[model samples]
Target chain A: MIVAVIALGLLAGASGLLLGFAAIRFKVEGDPMVEQIDAVLPQTQCGQCGYAGCRPYAEAIAAGEADINRCPPGGQNGIAALAELLGRDPKPLDPESGIEKPKMAAVIDEQSCIGCTLCIQACPVDAIVGAAKHMHTVIARECTGCELCLAPCPVDCIHMIPFAPSITTWKWTYPAVEVKAAA
Target chain B: MSALFPFHGGLKTVRHKTESNQTPIQAGILPPRLTVPLRQHIGAIAKPLVQPGDRVLKGQMIGQPDGYISAAIHAPTSGVVSAVDQQPVPHPSGLSDLCVTIESDGEDRWIDREPVDYHRLHPSELRQTIRNAGVVGLGGAGFPSAVKLNLAGRSEPLATLMLNGAECEPWITCDDRLMRERAAEIVAGLQIMAHLLGPAEVLIGIEDDKPEAIAAMTAACAGTSYEVRPVPTRYPSGSVKQLVKLLTGRETPVDGLPVDVGVQCFNVATAYTVYRAIHCGEPVISRVVTVTGQVHRPGNLEVLIGTPFAELIKQCGGYRDGVERLIMGGPMMGFALHSDEAPVTKAANCLLAAGPAELAAELPVLPCIRCGACMDVCPANLLPQQLYWHARAKEFDQARDCHLFSCIECGCCSHVCPSHIPLVQYYRYAKNEIWAQEKEKQRAEQARQRHQARMERLEREKQEREAKLRQKAPVRTEVVPHLDPLISVPSPTKGEGSGQVG
Candidate 1:
């Protein structure tokens, strides 16, 4: 038993040491590019992209996997600048994606409200605050400005109004087209 | 074909070609008018050379080429420029863009023409002349042919010039008709392209479904160093990349072009146009378009560019009863036309006037059942179900890690989705969302910079104010009060917000 114990102990010690050395030797270098991309991404966590979160999208951008134009929430400017970062020709927001328009959130017109919370159920991000057969109001700040709530209201009580652009939410316009650099 | 180079994974899509491909392509009678869009070719929108109230000859140039990458617009029939403003264009979005409307004088007269013996001219001179003739890809891609032919001189070392006759799209039969009717001209164009690229072997890749085209190409290419290779009809088989791989045994790396693989492919129609441009000195003014789907009498018609969809439909015997979806091009990857009034452009290959009985109406999208159907048919080897999930959930980052950008939006995912979900639409949505977020961030940075500059200006003003106050005291022996009554001294407030360095 003692002999077997010593052999196991030696094996464990060797493996532990090797693992420790590897951990020390191969530390990951975080890229500033990822951080820059992350700063650009809208952190709505809408999961509109296949990624788990916005950070993964940023990481993908840094890795040259994600196109800048994929973000509906980020809109046109996001794609243009992403084209800037990747040093590729900036194409218009692919029409395959829906055209970019001013953002608006669903506003429940209380007077027309039949107290049917159908709009509440349709709210993907759960920005609606109301009860069944009672008046509903939208939490504007939490809304992703998707306007999904407008469709479900049977009586058309829910109306979409344009959201004001804030300093924190604004983006730079696409730069003028220039000759492409060698990748 | 070598087993190592065999192309695979193609879907047997429904063919609605009986409506159009059965009849031989007919030349259309002269129309009352035509509306030519300046940006007909691949490059920038050409500048308008003729204005309204100006009379033009049949071959008059209306829109001049913007740059080397662009093609010029020509008058299809002798006409007067009625309008050169925004008109409804046949795009998926149904938006209005700049167009030149010409009212035909009904006299189909050709201007005194000049022809060039391309065999005697140098390759560079031939290419420049082809550009001047406004020859471009008659294929759906619409890339300037002169620009593509010029790439032969690049050190990439091209080995083959392929004539793509694989009209794989369900309803479009333009390329097939071009090969069937104008095979010799296409061959002449191929020889011209081969001369430019020198001793480059020509391979005409036609789908097996188009045996007539294959036979015609074979007969036309009998005396030359060209081979007509029949490939299996596949959705996207006509795509330049897939055709190249099928013919030359080369795979173009992602984001790289067919030229990178030592192979260059052109549409059979484009090749025929090059022949016409080189030999007859005739610029591309018209093309063959397949009018099919729910129309009463459907067939291919050689129509002039900028002719309204209404006119084409009228020539095709109009729509039958409840014509629902009007798609420009094939059902697989075509854009839905917004209205019947929109004029057809160079990119339009087919106009599908689908009714409820012929084409199914868009059904309500259900949750994905994870049946793995999307994966089985994805040409790009992507997990479309995962992409749909991320797109629905707005998890664009995860989609990116899964190579979302590589999803070519070919509509295969949407086509095969058992859930009836418009998967392509979702992917597009995800892409747009990600783009919007990036733009928002950029705007914020710009705003921050502007705010910073304003803060700096305020600081400088405060500093100057203090300096003046000190100077006044120094000049007035520490107790002197007023000097100039015209200027009143105002004290500054202390509250200054710190700026974020952009």
Candidate 2:
């Protein structure tokens, strides 16, 4: 009886020491899952996910504090990808978030005056470039169509325009009716 | 005779060649207007050289080839440039594309012509000449022939130079007629290609159904090393991979081309055009098009590029009664065009005016019963059921893993499907969606890279600004050091006193 008890006690101590050493030696500095989730995000930084940025929302989702379907810009495709990655059931996008739409970019009207630089400050990606009381232009390639700058612009010169399909971007639509007779 | 290697599954479709191949090739009437799409060949759209009101002569280069993979566009006949804007093109999308409309002057004048000595010219020069002449694969692929002749820049010796005379598509008889009528010119083009590539052997694979075409080609190939081999008639047997397999007993590797196996194939019509370009100094402005099905005078017409379909149909006695749909290419792999107003491009081989009896009737789509009919006819040997399931579910990655890209979109699976499912359409949808996703991923990556670059530039600028400020105000740092002792002495004295007490 004594030998059995001592053997059990020794085993427990050894396991406890090994586990403690492993905890100290192999501890990860940051949740890698959060980084993975952040990489998959559209990275608009629109704060529609109730977080300040895409990284923070990814962190929240990784920490199990936020749902994966909160991002509207990502749409159903994004939700499905996230679900696949996290090994969870896919869900529809939350209705509270905005609906998914075609990719768009912000275009600024140069004719409008009174550049107060409010929009420049509001832009999260620094896509807009201007000085005080001067004409400002949005870099169409850089603008993610976040709409955060739209409200801050006093002149309301900013407009989100959907990308026009060029010859290269056009894809063939599915045939409406299948031919049943063989030629 | 070379031993033939059979490919996977294929069907023996009915031959409708008797309708169109019964008569000799006839020249099409000149239309009042020609609306030529800039993107006739597969790659980049040709750049327009003429604006509205510019008078262009016949065979005058009006649209320059944009890049390496593009083909030059020419005015089909002497005409004034009416407009260079979006016009209806013969595509499955039913959308408009940029086209150059020419108003015919009826003169049909040709530009100054001079044949080139291809033997004396360097291979690159020959290729450039061919490119300038706007020669492309007339087998409906419309790939720039110069690009294919360059052998993808591989130095390995070419083994077989195969000429495709296998007009396996049921309704298309243009190639067959070309071989029968213009066999000598096609052989001359083949000799030129052989001179360029120096392949060990030259073989022309024509279907046995056209015994006359095979005999003509064989007689033309006499006194030369080129061999005319008759292949079994089968649907899609004229496809480059399948033809290569049939003639050489070699299988093209998945995700690889025929050239990788030291074989190169060209259509018989493409060879004829090459001969015309090199020997006659004429660019590709017209081709033999099979105008059959529901037309009163159903036969082959050597039609000019950019001639509207309506004008061609008028020459063929117009559409007969019960004409339901107009299709471009063969009935098996062709797409239903929206309007007869669409112009004929270089890629169009046949303009099928399908009637009720000709086209498949619109039937209610039935669910896939998993009867394995599609599997039995799949030329690529893919599991159509699995592909359909995954593609319908938008599981593209899984579909890709099943060698989705290898499928040639031959429509064999859809043709044999008992359930009436458009298997080819599903495969096309999945392929397109995957391409779209890949493009999106690329754009996202580029954006991320740009953002990182912008951040790095900003940080460097900030550091540079600080350094410049320090350079501009050297006196401030000297003054600060002198005043530092006065501010620091009391604090150090207090610290020293505390240390002594401790």
TM-scores (chain A) of the candidates: 0.56, 0.87
Clashing pairs in 2: A181-B360
Angstrom error of the Cα, residue A141, model 1: value is 30
Once superposed on the true structure, which residue ranges of model 1 sit more than 4 Å away at CA?
Answer: A1-183, B1-4, B431-502
Off by over 4 Å in 2: A1-31, A44-47, A50-56, A63-66, A108-144, A147-155, A165-167, A172-183, B468-475, B482-502
**Candidate 2, position A119, lDDT:** 84
Per-residue lDDT tens digits for candidate 2, residues B265-289, read 9999999999999999999999999
In order, the Cα lDDT scores of the candidates are: 0.75, 0.86
Tens digit of per-residue lDDT, candidate 1, span B86-111? 88777655666788998988987777
Here, model 2's chain A TM-score works out at 0.87
Q: Model 2 — interface RMS deviation?
A: 12.1
User: If scored against the real structure, what TM-score would every candidate get?
Assistant: 0.67, 0.88
Worst 10 residues of 2 chain A by lDDT: A174-183
